[model samples]
Target: MRLLLVEDDEHVAAALLAVLKRHGFTAGLARNGAEAIEKTQAGGFDVVLLDLGLPDADGFEVYGQIRRLSRIPVIMVTARADVRSRIHGLNLGADDYVVKPYDTGELLARIHAVSRRAALDQASSDGPASGGTGGAPAPGGQVLTAGPVTVELSTRRVLVDGARVELTRKEFDLLALLAQRPGVVFRREQIISDVWRTSWEGTGRTLEVHVASLRSKLRRPELVETVRGVGYRLAVPPAL
Candidate 1:
């Protein structure tokens, strides 16, 4: 797999580069956000490891630039451990966030998880059923409508009452997953595994945070109901 590693710390970069190479990744290194942006535009990277405290720009800014250009998966690697930082990174379209001093093995796991999701996204994009031509519509291609909310599966766009709603990538994915199965209760574990394609490590609150953000953006807090002791379900009818 090809990966981009954007970090200004030489020592950390060297260590991570070796680890990634040892795991059969053709890793490219960028010392700053500017280079990261430049390299990304050059294409061919399957994933990006971004550091927030870049010399030229913040990681979030880099993330915005990348999102404007492509839907490539990004994992933020930063020393900041605050909840606000993590939330901000994820809200800016990062697939995941790893704090500095993280375990290399855990980082590898995250890379694998994000890579799997990217592959799924590509597969969904190429599925003939999703208007890819020459086949039936993809199961994921069905448009979801609930009251004033309209979610277009192919484009991953969420519209509320005809107005486009701005949502972070994670929020959009989470909302789409729930809306795809209205009234079908999904446990937090299931959501983590399905949406993130990874095992839950007692970090279900991340799902809750994204769900809350989705509700806020949808402007209908009651759209998603929390089942006590279980999980969450979209209030829309299944047949809708």
Candidate 2:
């Protein structure tokens, strides 16, 4: 898989590049966050190894920007080994977090794992079935309605109580997933795996955040009900 190594340390970057080459993987180097973002925006890279300490911008900032700019997976390869930093990075949507002095084999394994997951996610999105459930898209522009809310699957739009409700891509996916089987509780792990398509354990909080955002955006706090340590389900069961 192609990788972008975003480390300012030349010695570290050079050594990692050699290792990557020996593994038959192509990689490009970015000395700072700006270069990393630029290279990422230019596309072609499959994954990114970001170091936190960048000259022009914080690696976290670059990471957030990259996620917003594209769906490419990013892994944090930094010396910030603190639990807080790891959680923070993962919560910000990183595919994986690898500390400094990580085993070369493990790093390569993580790279492959994230790439594979990304491929699966892309395939699912482009396949005949839409969203996490793998259900075929409804013909004639299917729409799901639950109480005051409505979801337009083909157009990726939502309306609540006859008013339009805007949603982010992730938010829309989460909503559509729950809408697939309203009143059928979806485990948090299932939600994370389906929406984010990564096995990283730190993404549970992201799931919670998205659920909450969906509630707020849909303008009905009780529209998505928490199942108390289990998961969430649409408050109103489906009719069609």
How many residue pairs clash (N, CA or C atoms closer than 3 angstroms) in each of the candidate models, in the order given? 4, 0
Kindly report which residue pairs in candidate 1 clash with one another: 129-136, 129-137, 129-138, 130-138
List per-prediction Cα lDDT, in the order shown.
0.78, 0.79
**Candidate 2 local lDDT, 1-240, one digit each (tens):** 588999999999899999988755779999998898899999999889889989899889999988888889999988888999999999999999999889886676677667656754654455455343233334442566666667766667677777778899999878877775466676676676667877638998888888888888777888899989778888883456
Relative to the unseen true structure, what is the C-alpha lDDT of residue 42 in candidate 2, on a scale of 0 to 100?
97
For model 1, what is the error of residue 171's alpha carbon versus the real structure, in angstroms, after optimal superposition? 29
lDDT of 2 at 209: 85
Q: Mind sharing the TM-score for model 2? A: 0.54
* Worst window of 10 by summed lDDT in candidate 2: 132-141
lDDT of 1 by residue, 117-162 (tens): 6755765665445333322233543466766677665556678777
Model 1 residue 27 CA deviation (Å) reads: 0.6
